[model samples]
Target: MRYDVNLSILFTELPMLERPAAAARAGFDAVEMWWPFDGPTPADAELDRLAGAVTEAGVQLVGLNFDGGHMPSGDRGLLSSPATSRRFRDNIDVAVGFAERLGCRTLNALYGNRTDDTDPELALENLALAAKAAGGVGATVVVEALNSFENTRYPITSSAQAFQLLDQVPGTAFLADFYHLGRMGEDLSALIANHADRFGHVQIADVPGRGQPGTGELDYAAILRQLADSPYDGHVGLEYKPVGPSEESFSWLEAMP
Candidate 1:
């Protein structure tokens, strides 16, 4: 499995624009990120400058997320919210355009937290729109399961739940994030054994602590072997929070089977 650092989480020691270069210096030719802007539609110049930085750093931007509203405040995503539907729609072009500019072919749309009155249909509608927009650039829209313990209000807390929602949206794919799935008590070996052919992207952090592989109870060695033997061929993203300086967190990668 090819690996790419998740710049949003891994390289926070530097300014946002410098993270790509940091990844390159650390021997990574590819990187991915959560949305880096405060708002969905950043000015063209801001977008250009960021694109230029990634280009100059000589690393490929492999994946990106849509604008999830106010992430630090626990707002998971916007696509499903009736109040934010317009905002989510408006961001589709800008996000996909940025992905296109950098040759990134995968876009992830986190299903938002559900409220007492949330409509699942609305979420599906918005996701379909996202899938269609991404298709224009030959990119795919992937959905992942987030653990309910941390994401309290977020729906789709298991791979099963995520697939239930994704089932209705054709041509879309699954984002197998082992960190959240393991938190939900998913059997990593079983998941790869069964659904490896359907994965569009993969992210991993250890169970319990959400840190690098050895920081918690995850059996990454077995999981890596499963992925290696399966038909799934894609980037495995290191999406964990580092225990110390981000650069120090990757000793585990060298140990990958």
Candidate 2:
């Protein structure tokens, strides 16, 4: 299976544009992002520059996360508060353009939550609308499931829930996050095997501190084995923060299988 490291977290010392090169030097085939927006909004020039950097690095932009507000105290993404839906949709277009420029085929659509004023059906409809738009640009949208205990604002917590919501959208698929799945007390192998075809991408983070795979309770071996056995074939996104130096943190992956 090809590896996809999140450039933002993996190489925190470098500029975002230079991250792909660092990932390439580490023997990774591709790179991803939690989110690449410079601010609450998207910028055309910045997106162009990022796309250029990816091409220059000789690595693929395997995944692009559309989950906005991923930064500290920043809020506004595909599924944020009701008032931000318009801005969110605009950002979706910008994200697709950026992905297209980078030759990326998959884009993550993280569902942001609003507990006070929004209805579930409305949010689902909005998600469907966004998915359809993403599909138009030849970029598949994968709905992300984050453990609520860790990512408090993430609306979908379980693989089952993610599948249910994604099912509402004709072409949208699932993203099984290992760290979140473990945190929610779900069976990682079972979830992956059951929804093999529906899964478009995956992410990793060890519990206890969200470190490398080998440092936590997660069975990276079993997870990789299950993926090998399943029909799914996609990039495994590394989304955890490095406990020490970035280059030293990836030693755990050598023992993944």
Candidate 3:
């Protein structure tokens, strides 16, 4: 199974631009990250600096997230936020352009938490816009579900919930984030077998702690074995938060069957 490190989570001990090299040093050849700036559109030089760091590290950027507003502040994303619709629209082409430049083909668009103002029709429209923008540059736009316990306001929290969006918007793909799904007590193996065809980009973090695999209850070896046998063939993103120093958290990688 080919794996790509999520630089945004894995190498936080280092500077943002420095994480790519750190990931490379830890033996990863491909990496992914959330938008690398506080704003949707950063200065050209800032983008240049990040691109240079990735290129210099000799790693392929395989996946990227559309600019979701400040995540730590509990803003899940702008895709379906009525108050932030303009910001989400303004970010689509810019994100797609950067992804094309980095040879990345998968772009994840996080669905915002459901608010009193949430509009289902507006959300579908934004998702369609994102799908079209990414298609223009030969990239696929992926939608992901988050667990409700922590993301209490986020609407799409189950594999079935995320898969339902695929029918509403053609060309929209599903991002199966195992951590969130697992935390919700979903039958992962059964879901993998059933929805294998819709899997676009997959991410994993052991639940109960959101740490690397093997640190929590998930049997990654068995899960991975099943994933390897499934029809879905895409990079399994290591998107877990580490227990300690990020570099030291990869022992599971070598031990995985």
For each candidate, what TM-score against the reference?
A: 0.98, 0.93, 0.98
Q: Which runs in model 2 stand beyond 4 Å of their true positions? A: 74-76
Whole-model lDDT values for every prediction? 0.91, 0.77, 0.90
lDDT head-to-head 1 vs 2, winner:
1
Q: Model 1 TM-score?
A: 0.98
TM-score between model 3 and native: 0.98
Kindly list the per-residue Cα lDDT of model 3 for residues 1-257, writing each as its tens digit: 88999999988989988999998999999999987788888888988999999999999999999988989899988877689889989898889989999899999998888888898888899999999989988889999889999999999988888888878998888998899999999999998888978888999999889999988999999999899899889999999999999989999987664
* Top lDDT hit: 1
Which lDDT tens digits does candidate 2 get at residues 1-257? 77888987789899898888888888887988867775435666777778778888888888887746545663425464576566566676777777787778888876766457556766677677767777887878887777777567666788878877877788888887788888898987778777788888888888867888877887788888889779888888888888888878888777665
Q: Compute the lDDT of residue 119 as modeled in candidate 1.
A: 71
Q: What digit string (tens of lDDT, one per residue) describes model 1 on residues 23-134?
A: 9998899999999998989999999989998999999999999999899999899877788877888899999999999999999998888876577888899999999999
For model 2, the local distance difference test gives 0.77
**Candidate 3 ranges beyond 4 A from true positions:** none
Give the worst 10-residue stretch by lDDT in candidate 1: 111-120
